[model samples]
Every structure is written in C-alpha cells, then in structure tokens.
Target: MNKIFAKQFNKRALAFGWGMVMAMIIFMSTAWFAFTTTNQKISAEITSLSILEDYYKEQDRLIAYSETSSKLALSQSFYQLAKDSAIDITNSCKVINNVMVWNNNCHPNADFVKQKFLEYYDTNFNSFMLEYPNKMDITYTNVLENTTLISRASPVTFSSEKQGTFAKYNFTYNFEPSIKINLTEQGISLEDFESIYNKILECNKKIECFQKINLENWDISTESQGSWFLFKLKTKKPFIFYENDIENYAPIELNFIIEL
Candidate 1:
C-alpha cells in the first residue's frame, strides 16, 4: 500500500510539472507575439492598403482585357482573381485575428476585422482552386508581411496529378481583399482603429454602397466619439445637396472587401 501511494504521488507530481511547463511556454509565446504586434499590424495594413492602388490599376487592365475577349473568358479571369483574393484575405484575417486574440488585441488594424468574420469565412468561403501548390501561386512584396495572403497571386501551376480516370485539381488562389479609406491621415489610437473596425458592420448594414464600399458619392461624418465616424453615401439619384458629395471630389476609387 505504501509503495502504491508513493507511485501515484510521483505520477501526479510529474503531470503537474508538465502542466506548469506548458503554461509557461504558452504565456511566453503570447507575450512575444504581443510585443510590437501593433507596429507589425500597422505595417501590414499600410502595405495592404498601398497594394490597393496596384489592384485598381489591375482592375482597369482587367476591364480592358475583358473588352477584347469573350465575357466567358473575362469572367473566368475575374473569378480567378476574386476567388484567389477572397481566400487569401480570409486566411490572413483568420491568422491575424488568431494572433490578436491570443495576444489580447495588441493592435486591431484593417485586417483584424469582426470577431465572427473568420467564422463566417470558414462557413461560407472555399479555396479558389487547389490544383497548384501555394508556392507557385504567390509573390511576397513584404516578406515580414508574408502571413499567407500577404503574398500576391503568382498564378502558376507547378504540378498536377491524374488518377485512373479523373484528375484532381491542385492550384491555389485566395480571392484578394483590401479596403481603401480616403480620409486624411489623422491621429487615431489603436483603440480608435479597433472601434471603427467593429462598427463597420453595424454602419454598413443600412447602406448597400458602403456595404460594398465602392467609395462613391459618399462622405464620412467627422462628429462624436472622436473614435468612430458615420460613413454616409447618397443612395438615391435625385441629387440631394450634401456637404461633401462623393462626386464633388475624388481621392481614389479603391476596392476592398467587407468580409461578405
């Protein structure tokens, strides 16, 4: 009886020790990820938003390319780009949100969208086309920003497989996503950025244009809370005189996703 009791005690002690070690490891990892994650996210958002300019140019090119070709061919190109982009952004958001929640919301940027955002993607979004390996499909402008979606579409099929009668597709393309804001570079805290991100869904629900966020005939109300703003764009055609109309001035027509 004495020996059995001692063995049981020893086992308990060992398990407890391992549990403590694992706890420490997790704490350490969370701490390290928290360190300057804000700065890292800031850098990531900047790089992503900056890429939208190139995307707009690409959109123009796509439009022009479609005019010369059949709509079916044009649509294939668009679907390829959209599918590739959406999956990429969804993946990036998932990873970022994971890191953020794990790190206690260090710095919620444009990428760190709604809490249910990733959950929605997991339920609704599918990988573009998994025929090509991820490597041949992506190019990284910022290596540090290479969290997966950070790598732009390379669109190359390296290898493919064929079964007895059927061949499985194996290419990767994440439908891209990036939102553009024409507002001036104002001094907003990390919390403010987080607040606007959270409220975007709330405000966007009523406005289809803002929901798609085409940034047309719209102006963001700079009032109250100082942390959040009401972004409004006229939906009707009968020209109502607003202070800052979408047509009065144009900064840049940027394309971005609202997670849906």
Candidate 2:
C-alpha cells in the first residue's frame, strides 16, 4: 500500500511540473508578441514624423525662393528701363530680347542679341554673360493688346537736397510664364510634393505675366504622403499689361513671404 501510495504521489508531482512549465511558456510567448507589436508601432510613427519634418523644411525653402525672386523683380533696374520708352530697345526691335544681358541678369549665350551687341556695339558679351549667365534667359513680350507703350511714374531725386521728381517710362512688353505639369513619374514623398507646389506658386506670384496655373486632378486614394512620389503642375503666363502701366503707380517692389 505504501509503495503504491508513493508511486501515485510521484505521478502527481510529475504532472504538476509539466503544467507549470507549459504555463511559463505561454506567458513568455504572450509577452514577446506584445513587445514586438509595440516596437513596430513606434517605428512606423517615427517614419511618419520624419517625413513630415522633411516636408516642412522643403516648404520653407520654396517660400524663401519665392520671396527672393519677387524682391529681385521689383528692385531690378530693368523695371526702370521698361517704363522708359527711350531705353526700351537695344537695337530698335519691338521686343527687348537681351535685357538680361545689359542688366547682367544672365550668362552669355549664342543668341541673336549677343551677336548683334558684339558686332554693332563693339563690346564683349561674354563678360556680362559670364557674370550673370543664369539671368540671360529672362525676356519679356507684349503685355497689352493694341498698346505700343506702357508708362509708370516713379519718384526720383537727383540729389539728397533736391526735390524728388516723377519719371514716366514706357514698357512695350512683359515677361510671362508658361507652366506645365508632368505626371509620367511614380511615387513621391509629401515633402517633395509640397516643395514643388510651393515653387510653382512662388514663380507665379513673382512673374507678373503669369495669368493662370493648371494642375491635373489628384486622386485621393493614391496621393497620400510618402517618399519617392511624383505629381504634375502646369501654368500659363500671358502678358496682360505693361508693368509700368499697372493701375497703381508706385515704386516697383516685390514682397516675399516664407512659411514653415
């Protein structure tokens, strides 16, 4: 009886030990699963935050560019020249093809204006172009319909002590922008998208000739913010009026605003 009782007790002990081990294993597995799930959630959140931060930075940059471009347009001496009919043309052509060259806005290029200036003016276009190569492509065309000249009256003073004078100048043409959006590409991040968008807006604002901007409709389902994405932007710039002939005659100036 004693031996039987001892053997029964041993069996019970063994079963209990097995049960405990199983319980431990189940607990450990549950803990591990919970840890893994939490980790993944944290990682995803981090990624999203990073993307948002990048997007903000890109937007800031674009705004800065816009402001700078606007200010440059306003302060340019060419604005003065455009207002004055006597200085509107370089070689008697209705269009001023090379204001960038004279204003040192662009680099020298193999264009008719450069050739003509070098041949007739006996000046090296390369020097001006070298200093301002990027500025050369800036050009303007007729801004108004059936109007040969536009005038702007700006306050001017010959000397600090002298009374200020108002000068009237005529501009025959203005620079307009033509924007087009290309949607041939694939996925892009939110940051990049915002960057491109802001740039388009800024350019439109700075270029007085831009009349409208057209964009393809965005699909809400696929347009979510992500890295390595693509979109489209398009704009049309039409000369509406001479800068000088703007309804408000005041100092030509540009205002720049940056939002982060």
Candidate 3:
C-alpha cells in the first residue's frame, strides 16, 4: 500500500509540472505575436509619412516652376514690343491731332498737313523700329476717306448762382490705317509663343489682354502683309488746347487704333 501511494503522488506531481510548462509556452507565444503586430503598425505609419513628404515636395517644385514661367512670359521681348508699339501709336495720334487743330488753326493746308503727319510718323515709328530691330516685316497703309470731325462744348460758371456756357474748340479727324507686325525672324518659335501666351494668361488672370482690338471699322489683313497678325485701326480723338495747364489736360480721348 505504501509503494502504491508513493507512485500515485509522483504521477500527480509530473502532471502539474507539465501543465505549468505548457502555460508558460502559451504566454511567451502570445507576447511575441503582440510585439510583432505593434512593430509592423509602426513601420507602416513611418512609410506613409515618408510618402506624404515626397508628394508635397514634388508639389512645391511644380508651383515654383509655374510662377517662374509666368514671370518670364510677361517679360518677353515680343510682349514688350507690342505694348510699346501701342503706346507710341496712341501718343503719335494725339500729337498729330493737336498739331493739326492748334498749330494750323483748323485750316491746315495740304502740304502742312502732309508734312506734320510725316514728321510725327518718322519720329515715333523710327524710334520703335530702332528699339526692336529684330522685329521685321512692318507694313503701313493710310486710307483717307472723308474726314470726320468731332466738336465739343464746355460749361462755364459765371457767378455763384448763375451758370454760363462757352464753346471750347476741339476737333478730331478720323483716318484709317492698317498695320502689320511680323516676328518670323526674331528667333522666336511657335512653342515659345505658346508658352509666352500661356504665361501671360496666368499672370493677367483674364483673356481680355489677349483679345483682338480694333481702333475703327477698317478692313484688316494679317496674312497679306507677311505678318503673324494684321488689323486696321481708326485714328480719331478730341483735340483740346490749354495754354495755362497744358500738361494738366492736353488731348482727350485720343485713339490711335491698332489691330493685331
């Protein structure tokens, strides 16, 4: 009986030891699984952050490029040439109108009128060409139909309560002229033109700057003049003579009319 009891006790102790060993193995396996899962999650988050950083960096580069392109386009020689030409034409028209009305006293002779117009053209047009020598294929056409004259009146205040009216002698004679601008030999390519136009649009934020302008109702032919574009503009505006405040107000509503 004693031997049998001893054997039963040893068997129970072995079974308990085996159960503890199994429990320890299970706990270690669970801890290892949890650690691996957490590590993988951290690695995935780090990778995602890296991807986002790269994306934003690329976006910044693109934005910088876009801005640079826009600025370059606005500063292009072609754009400057167009703007300067327009300003010159407008100023020349105003000068000629003033000369015809004030200098000749509205009774300009044929020779006087022709000479004044020629002088104004030579001075301004020549200056423009000299500045932009690369721009070739310039054609000028002057059409004289019936001279259309414009007149205006100014209100005169007599006293503190009474109002008076006086006639201010001002006139604008209408003339149609066709102008052609060519850039075929300016070392400019179609791709460059397109890029410049695109950049202009981006900077201006509107299509108005790129739209076609007509000074008067004249037939404009761009292709016939070997120009990239051609248009007819009417030269007309009010001529005002101010002796005292000549710089304050000289010519009003002067339009040199340009088509491009």
Stretches of model 2 off by over 4 angstroms after superposition: 74-260
In model 3, the Cα lDDT at residue 2 comes to 92
Q: How many residue pairs clash in each candidate?
A: 22, 20, 0
**Could you give candidate 3's per-residue lDDT for residues 69-157 as a string of tens digits?**
22222223223322222233333332332221111122213443333433443343434333432332333322222231111112211
Model 1, poorest ten-residue lDDT window? 181-190
Q: Which window of ten consecutive residues has the lowest lDDT sum in model 3?
A: 148-157
* TM agreement with the true structure for every prediction: 0.18, 0.32, 0.31
lDDT of 1 by residue, 94-142 (tens): 3321221111223235353322223332222222222222212333121
Model 2 agreement with the true structure over 1-260: per-residue lDDT tens digits: 99999999999999999999999999999999888777766665565566556545544543344333322332232223223211224444322222111221221222432233223211222222234423334222211112111111122111112111222222122222321111122111112223334444465433221223333322211111232112222111111122444533233221111111
Q: Evaluate all candidate structures by whole-model CA lDDT and list the values in order.
A: 0.34, 0.32, 0.34
Clashes of 3: 0
lDDT of 1 at 142: 16
Error of 1 at 4 (Å): 1.4
